[model samples]
Target: MAGTGGSNPSSAAAAPKILLAKPALVTAAKYNRGPGGGGGPDDSNRSRLPSVAFLNLLSDSWDFHTDRFLPFLTDNTDFTVVGVIGPPGVGKSTIMNEIYGFDATSSGMLPPFAIESAETKSLAKHCTVGIEPRITSERIILLDTQPVFSPSVLADMIRSDGSSTISVFGNESLPAELAHELMSIQLGVLLTSICHIVLVVSEGVHDNNMWRLMATVDLLKHNLPDPSSLSLSHPQSSDKEIKDKIQEAGEEYMASPVFVHTKLHERDSAPGYHVQVKKALNQYFSSTSFNKPSVDGGSDPTPLDLYFIPCKSNSEYQYESYYSSFWKLRDQVLSMSGPSFSRTVSERDWLKNSGKIWELVKGSSTISDYCRTLQNSGLFKR
Candidate 1:
């Protein structure tokens, strides 16, 4: 259902509205911390906690079960996975921290994120390297991923001519940075496959690169292979053929994309700032088809559930700074009783899906294929 949170400044009789949170929660925690485990410097005992584990790098391959929660997933609990993506330093983590019920100022109690007091502050660096899974309850799972467009990650994105703005590699061989970013995008696609909702947060306004990033996401989703139909027995099916099937099957009911415009100055001089953002986003998505192609066929226009949260700046009470608005957003999330998609995968299925997609990423001939696909599809066109 479309939300009533947005309104025109010129509309005089606007009713007070409560914005519904996308039917799930999105949050992130430190990779080293375990559920109910202390956030001490020592992670030597991490093996004991299966629920919170780190993802493997190229040097090390991750067995999905090793991240733990495999056994818990088998218990048949209906869990909602919420994935949060945003540009670096946009307060994605901090906003998620608050939504997960973490109050930075509270001393005696542990924050839901379980990070130490010192680690709570925002930093320019990519705090999350890979997918950091945090389980708030048996029914809730939050996947906090690396910030999109972080210099560390974008430095990996090579040009069409096989040259990056920054030289991570001296030769034409696929740079490790490109491979790594590809892996991250694959993870985001995997999350979309299983997540109940995907929350995309951005600071200020949307830019060309931001739109292109989202466009690539649309392509990936349209091309993502169906988990059930894919098997080791059928190794002959090409990626394009698989993608065709995915497109034919039609778009899976996904967590509706909720665009959050954060860090607003809340100035009296800018009373219409929120409305202006809503207007721009409405026009952008309407004109762009929300980054999906019309060749895929059209569905009814999906409501843009955009919400604005005031800038907290460097305040210690960042969560409290917009506590009232936060509460309303929080209530909407908690109250989401939306029915699950018929295509929703169970936890074990999610692991298998992850493994399958990871193999696809590794098997692809070149990372440049993604860039070309996005470009040819006109996803990044202004």
Candidate 2:
């Protein structure tokens, strides 16, 4: 099954014969079926219930038997599958440890699954993953690429050892210059995920990242989905993988109600981990069951009310250059962008900024006059 809120306990009490079909992982992902042909529980007598969202801990070779598999998404200790992205050293492990309670201070609990390279490290295998509440009848599982900040590293790992990484990289659009491509693509995916996304970077925010967000906004707004389902065999990918690509863009972010907590570590007493997420849910997530803050900041949601996670937890200076680089470009564009830009400006800065600006702003005075001068630039329109 793709995912589940909870299995019906009553199904077992009813003396139902549990279907014990050990379908291969690939088949499960492809068809979301048990050994039989359908999604129904193995024993038809059992009341049909959703399957728990399976966490796929992929590596150069997937390490399925890791300690502390589920991440703590909210105050009540919500359980959700988190995909860590980044090169090996960019703190994917460290971040996962922090979020999923992988305490080096203590042993952890490990769920049994297919794990490669089992000899690599010691698993704590102590703590239990929290029970998660069912939100939507439709599966609302979270799937992400690892190492939030190291887009370059994840790309490199995928390109070099991709044959062993996952079939998605093998049979998919391989990027040119993978250094940060995988991370970027994956971030783009979380930007559109089903649950709240916490894109953690050791460094602060940048313009390029915002542009990435805007690109998603534009595409989704224009009725385009990345790797648009129309272009690929939609029925083949696992539900988790499909959820990975849904970048959760809303019509609101275009108008600026989206609140971001960049350089979270830099914040002075940033409300601890739980408070911050609760605040984010009130800010970003819109649901009827949950309490939402008003636009005017009327009230706040409790810690248990939010569900968010850390995608990047940069420890060193790895993502610093990336953040700086994007900001430089972002500042240049925002320097002249309109209230509503038809084109999200990144991949075309030189032509769009210098060449286009020279044609538009050369006759202008200073930065103060940049925006107005660009009105007639005819660049964004072009």
Candidate 3:
């Protein structure tokens, strides 16, 4: 017999009474959890919601994290990966947000990539720490990375003695300055290998550091295979085999780059200035694969994929308005049928292979040797 105001232990263990509230709508917010009860319409609705606005693919320590982002990617093989790299305050994330098709005017809609706010600029802080990834409803993967050659990033990685705080180059200690440079190259190489389209953004028409960095990347990114070519079983493949794989793909594989020069003053938007800038860019990348002729037999001998974005403050000028340039950029980039991987690969596999490629980038002997050379030259303190 049960005691007064108390249930029998055996009866309570056999059938416990539980109360559950009505299942809430999880699709209305990002990263919402479904009802605890399994197998219901609520679960399906929760699955259909969009992924989180952004996930850090690579952390400030240069470590990779994929678990949070892998679920968002489907087995879609037709998607394209677009990556952007540039210096701070140059609007890299802003451009990526535009490419992400984010509705800025919508109330309560957070951007896929956060733009640099006035407060952030005043504090001299960078918005993105490492590589941030986002996938759109259209299955396009966008990667917004931390600003290269950033003083704040450098400061964070520098020790009191000026050695790197992060040990990316094996056991050897690297000067913060030299390590920062290598970071830029590694980023460029990884993007070129994995992405179908890479936007090389620069702040002003006169700033050519990003151009120089890409040239360095093209020079050092030898024998680094794209994600589709990477294999799990043959992780220890010989260099010759890797070289052969790259050769089989083509003479050399590089993501088609779209050079975006932003924040141009009104005078820089003049027709003459624009033509001069285009000519200069054509001459800069003339010898690289970026200048290679299209396989489709297009007319231009050295096709230049360049876009100039004027300053928003200069919208009062008679030339192309800021919004107009952005619209044109969006249309052109969306319509472009850029280069493809050697073989078809689903988005999940791509992410996995990309992780392996990043490991290769970090352990690259070429880069390691380059760091030693820089150290020997006394260019940076050890």
What's the lDDT for residue 289 in model 2?
A: 21
Residue pairs of candidate 1 with colliding backbone atoms: none
Q: For each candidate, give its TM-score against the true structure.
A: 0.64, 0.32, 0.86
Q: Where does model 2 exceed 4 Å of error?
A: 1-7, 10-92, 107-144, 148-175, 178-183, 196-382
Where does candidate 3 stray beyond 4 Å? 1-54, 230-233, 294-300
TM-score of 1: 0.64
Q: Report the C-alpha lDDT of model 1 over 289-364, residue by residue, as the tens digit.
A: 2433333466745446676666655354333355665666655655554335444354545555555655554454
Residue 184 of model 2 has an lDDT of 44
Q: In model 3, where is the ten-residue run with the lowest total lDDT?
A: 14-23
Model 2 is weakest, by summed lDDT over 10 consecutive residues, at: 126-135
Supply candidate 3's per-residue lDDT for 20.
16
Residue 270 error for model 1, in Å? 4.9
Query: What is the Å distance of residue 241 in model 2 from its true position?
Result: 20
Q: What's the lDDT for all of these models?
A: 0.49, 0.28, 0.74
Could you report the Cα RMSD, in angstroms, for every candidate shown?
11.5, 17.5, 12.2
Best by lDDT: 3
Report the C-alpha lDDT of model 3 over 28-65, residue by residue, as the tens digit.
34322122222223545446533343357886578777
Could you tell me how far off, in angstroms, the CA of residue 378 lies in candidate 2 after the best superposition? 21
Residue 185, model 2: lDDT of 41
